[model samples]
Target chain A: MKRDLALLLGILLALLAALLLWALHATLALEPGPRLAELASARLEQTGVSNPVTAVLLNYRAYDTLLELAVLLAALLGIWSLGPAPAGYQRSGPALAALVDWIVPLAILAGGYMLWVGGHAPGGAFQAGALLGAAGVILRLSGEPSAGLPGEPAQRWLVVLGAGVFALVGGGLLASGFGFLTYPPGQAKWLILLIESAATVAIGVTLTAAYVGGRPGSGTAHNGTGQSRTVQR
Target chain B: MADLLILPVLVPLLGGLLATALPVRSALVGTLAALATSLSGLSITLLVWLHGDLGTVLGGWGVPLGIGLSADGLSAALLAMASLVALAISIYAGSYFAGSAQARHFWPLWLLLWSALNGVFLAADLFNLYVMLELLGLSAAALGALTGKREAIAANLRYLLVGLLGSLTYLLGVALLYTAYGTLDIGLLGERLGPTPIAATALALMVSGLALKTALFPLHFWLPPAHANAPAPVSAALSALVVKASFYLILRLWTELFAPITDIGAATLLGLLGAGAVLWGSWRALRAQRLKLLAAYSTVAQIGYLFLFFPLLASLPPGTARDDLFAACVLMALTHGFAKAGFFLAAGLVQQKAGHDRISELGGVAQRMPATTFSIALAGSALVGLPPSGSFIGKWVLMRGAFETGQWWWLPVTVLGTLLAAAYVFRVLSRAFGLEPTPLQFVTNARTEIPALLLAFASVALLGLAAGPVWAVLGFGAAPA
Candidate 1:
């Protein structure tokens, strides 16, 4: 009876929300120009990217993207702090292991291509990074030790590399009196490409590390004091 | 000049990243970074207070086209409060987590959370605010679960989900506003907003979302467990600063964007809910068995007091009385920020010493730590609105405004909540006065005990006696009387 009551109430709330949304839709007046896109286009030359989205992500509103990377790193840090990685899955059979060996290198190549393409085309750091993360997932599924990633210390450095690089570039610009992330017109392209490349590698590592679901080995293997308590209810 | 405005957000981001990347496990680097971040933030606050509001358009793009950071009186007040409270918590945490494995995890996340708090206070663009809010929420949730206990993880999982829900709801509101207004800057949206169904619905979505994040009344269920179960410094930050960020946003949106569309009826409804929160939260706090849980519930009651000012502010005409009400609201919120951080830090010490926080078993344990006990006493007195504390002045102005507006009903609720606050505070204090050996020194473990004592002292002495500067800093011309 309680479940039925809750269901009924939930449906009623949904209907009410739909009604309100319909009323809102009827009254909203969308402006003629796509304002952000137009702004991006007007400043595209100075931003040094042929693609408007890349210009926006890397140049125009780079602060948001910087903080977004911090969010991803924070999630990975949270996972690692919980405990060391669970022991690797039972080693994959011969067929699966053989397949993984071929797939991993191709994924890395594809990630690099995507990273390079993001400067003038439809791809960007996040897309490239997702590809690399997929490779790590593939390796993990094949029961590879360390998930084809670095040790814990190297993993920590790699995870923080994207945000670290972004901040350095921004601060360097600020120090040079052009303000944060404000690349000069001629240098904008190279600077953005550099940041994006760094970002691609860092995001790829972070996402894969997050997927591994715990701290990397070798760092915590010897320090018993560092081990997080097993969660006991 | 723009560098000054941006540095508060930038320093912490850099510091956090460096702290995470560096192999140095000592807490010195993180503590110094936190110190620099707080000092930079304080300089910004001082500049804004002295020179009036300052705004900077990033990347040399003007408003409506690029993101900007702004510091008005509201931002300045909250920024100052966050800086002071965060610095104290940082110091407390440095000592509390010393030699623990979690120290490495604690510092970076804490700095990131500070960066997000400053970002939320200073962000001028709506979407930028959303990004900052997400960073704040994610870091806060992660920090909350750092204890790695089952209940901590469970509670903070719920917190994370609730935070995500709030952000999505707020983003939908921003979308609707952008759909109508052609811009996402708060100033431009304010100029374009009108009394329409879309605007009203957007208001509801955004406020409801913030209400959830702020833990207002009926939506406050997730706060207690999430707050009380975290490590002490994390709990201090969660209650004292994280929730206040959302409340600050709600206040900003209400005054800046929704002012033209708002009605008295809506204000009264919010005030009514505030009354409910005060009564319900305080009652629960009184009945709470654990020290941290009581502190958590007290936070709920304190938030209710903040909401109570809205209806009174809405009803009165634009003049000194209303301005006094507004200033009082800000003052009270700041006082609670300092007092609550002190309370939680001290409670953590008590819990650490006793191995548990069961209120019934805290008799000899609390009395042993004289310095921490004194810190709790001062914080509790401030919480209960005793004379010479900031809340006393704030409640005086608030109640006067209620009477002047002929909304006399809120007064009784305020009085009851105050009484309940006193009861719970005394319940803990009563334990301290029980038969036990007296300590030889008042300042024990100066590193941890001093932060709590200093914060509690500031809430009562600095805020109470020197509140005139707060009025002046907020750019109000003179006292309302």
Candidate 2:
């Protein structure tokens, strides 16, 4: 009976939503116009990037992107707070190690290429960062724990690099009489590249660290239970 | 001055980044950063209040393209309230988590949550609000689950998932809105909006999603568990500021973006659900076994009172009477923010002394902490809508508005909720007056006790007697026909 009632309620809600959607379809101007696309393209030259999407993400709506990085950082902080990173993956067999050795550097090179091409093409910080993170994943799979990542102290700084640099550059712009995230007219391209480089590195570290799933020392403990530190009572 | 609007968001974010990087010095850095951030936020609010609304398209990109941040009377007032409460929470947290291993984790997340709260209040772009909402949810859930207890982690996992679903639904609505209007700016959409099926669907998706976040009745199932299971400071912030951010968005949407499309029938439906929340939440709160659980349920009830204003807002024509009701709604929400934070802080201390918050066994602990007990009493009176409290003023205006609109049925519900609130508050306070030897001094630790007392005192003394400024700050003049 309880399940039936819930089902009934769900159905009723769905029907209500459908009806509302139907009403909106009938009365609203539901057009698929290229509103932002057109606007971005028009303002693309001034925004200091060739790709309209890049212009939008890095310039026109950079504030959202800035906060997005913060969101990523916040998630990592939450995970770290829970416990230390688990111990490194078990040592891979020699065959897998050979494969990882070949794959990882190629991934890094590809990530660098993606970062460089992001200014005028379909590559940017996030894409490049994802490539770098993939390399870390390969290292982890091959049982090279730490996933090619640094220790806890260094990892902390690496994780913050994206948001820290973004904020610093934003503040720098504001100090120079430009609005926050507003690159000066002629300097937009270089600044964008500089910010993207930092973001790519930060994102790569954060993704890999998250995959590592605990503080650096967590995996070192032979027992399943990680060390728990208690603050002063 | 338009540029100052970004400071509230930037300062805490920078602080969070700094704390995240410098793990060894996070506590000291986090505290100083929180203090600086709150002071700067308060100053920005004052600047806007004195100078009128300030808005700027970020990166100098015009509307329809760039995201914008605006600080009007509404945003400014809430920003000021949030900052003050956050400052108190930061100070309380400093001592609460002192020397704990988790302290490093707490500061960065707390600062991030602070930044998100400011971001939500100040965001003028729809998609921007989505990003801010997601940030707020992640940080809040993480903070809420800091205790590492089985129940705390489980409850927060559910919270995190629920928050994700709500944001995704809200994002769908934003997508629909952008498709229809070609812009995500609130003002631009408001100017272009018309009553249509797509608009209706957008409104439903957005409002329902926000209602879930706000923990409105029927959708509020996730709230109490999450609120009650969190650490005390986290509980305070969750109840006082985080949940209210969602409701603020709902109010902003209903009055501004959806005004043209909002129907009286829809408003009445919301009012009915609110009534259900008030009655049901109060009853649950009254019967709750744990102190924090009771506080959490009371949060549910208080949120209902805020929603009761919607029907009145829809019924009344645009004029002073409507404006008065609007201001009163904001006043009630602000009062609850202060009152609830004070109650939770005091409750935390009491629990610390007793080692548990089982209300029936709190007698010995209650008698010892006279200052903490006093804080609860004051905050409780405000919660119960006793006279000389801001909630008293808020409830008065609410009831009067109901009468004027001839919606007299709401009065009985309001009265019953108030009485139930009073009963539960006194039930807890009754423990304090027992025959155990009481402390001769009113205060025990000024560091901890002062923040709670000051918040409770402001809810009653400052807000109740000096509410004229709220009206002026909202830019509403004396009532006009």
What interface RMSD do all candidates show, one decimal each? 2.0, 2.2
- Clashing residue pairs found in predicted model 1: none
DockQ of all candidate complexes: 0.56, 0.62
**What TM-score goes with each of the models?**
0.97, 0.96
Q: Which candidate is the best by TM-score?
A: 1
Model 2 over residues B337-447: C-alpha lDDT tens digits?
999999999999988888999988887688878889999999999999997888998899999999999988889989999999999998888876666776675438887
Off by over 4 Å in 2: A1-34, A218-233, B439-443, B478-481
Worst 10 residues of 2 chain B by lDDT: B434-443
Q: What is the lDDT of residue B409 in candidate 2?
A: 82
**Residues A135-226 of candidate 1: C-alpha lDDT, one tens digit per residue:** 99888777764678988678888888888888889889888998877777699888888888889989899988888788776644735746
- TM-score of candidate 2 on Cα atoms, chains taken together: 0.96
| Counted clashes in each candidate structure | 0, 14
- Candidate 1 lDDT over B360-400, as tens digits, reads 88887887788899999999999999978899999999899
